[model samples]
Target: MRLFDKEKGLFISGPEKQISCASQIWMILAGVTDRETGINIIEALDHCPDAEGMSSPYMYHHRIQALIDLGLKDRAYREMHEYWGGMVNRGTDTFWELYNPQNPDESPYGGIVIHSFCHAWSCTPAYFLRKYYY
Candidate 1:
């Protein structure tokens, strides 16, 4: 039973499966797989936008970080704005609210939670830009 064999038995599956695969591929290309792959995962991510909806901030953050890593500060800034903008339009105040725990056994916190998240989300790019580009 080979891992990553798409035709195998039971395996993980979902709408974001493609993005997960891409992340693994990117990691491999980034030399995390071996001592000689010597590939830039960040550049690879910058070239691929199909993984934009994986529901993982770390993944999305990495994509933006990759853009920055590749010296595309302006593009990264733009992408960050677009990303948070979409989240905002969806009524989520912050990215965390989209995934944060609401109560001890439920979903998001709602209301101020959304607003707080949005504020933080909106500030991220500006913070990054000021810290790295300015």
Candidate 2:
């Protein structure tokens, strides 16, 4: 794989490959390389199938939010549909707790503790898109 470093940040690419859960989360927020070629974010999730299944709702929600920021409403809405559809198939209750979160009174942890690496990488586009696009 080839890695590129620019003022924006670091990016890696090549024939499809697996990245650590930490790195995958980073790339998502950082935005995939060569978006013009239509590198779908969904493709990256394949590397973390368990995370995908466990956190699909959050991931999809973030993607939709990112799409909206990119002014890709059509794509965002389509993803929303797919997300809800997947929830229907997978059973919404199975993942609802992660979204709702819980207090100590309710549970030991409050909501899912998604790593900071995941947050920074997953949300990077919303923060740096103008640098790359505008």
Q: Candidate 2, residues 15-60: lDDT per residue as tens digits?
A: 5433333444345556553453223443444443443132434555
> Which model scores highest in lDDT?
1
TM-score for each prediction? 0.44, 0.36
Alpha-carbon local distance difference test for all models? 0.47, 0.41
The C-alpha stretches of model 2 lying farther than 4 A from their native spots are 1-10, 13-54, 89-134
Task: Output the number of the TM-score-best candidate.
Answer: 1
Clashes of each: 6, 3
Inter-residue clash pairs, candidate 1: 93-114, 93-117, 93-118, 94-117, 94-118, 102-107
Scored against the true structure, residue 72 in model 2 reaches a CA lDDT of 67
- Note each model's CA RMSD in angstroms: 8.3, 10.5
Tens-digit lDDT track for model 1 on 1-134?
12232332111236534444345444543534332221333344345556333443445565566556556678777777776666666675556433222221223344443333433433555567677877
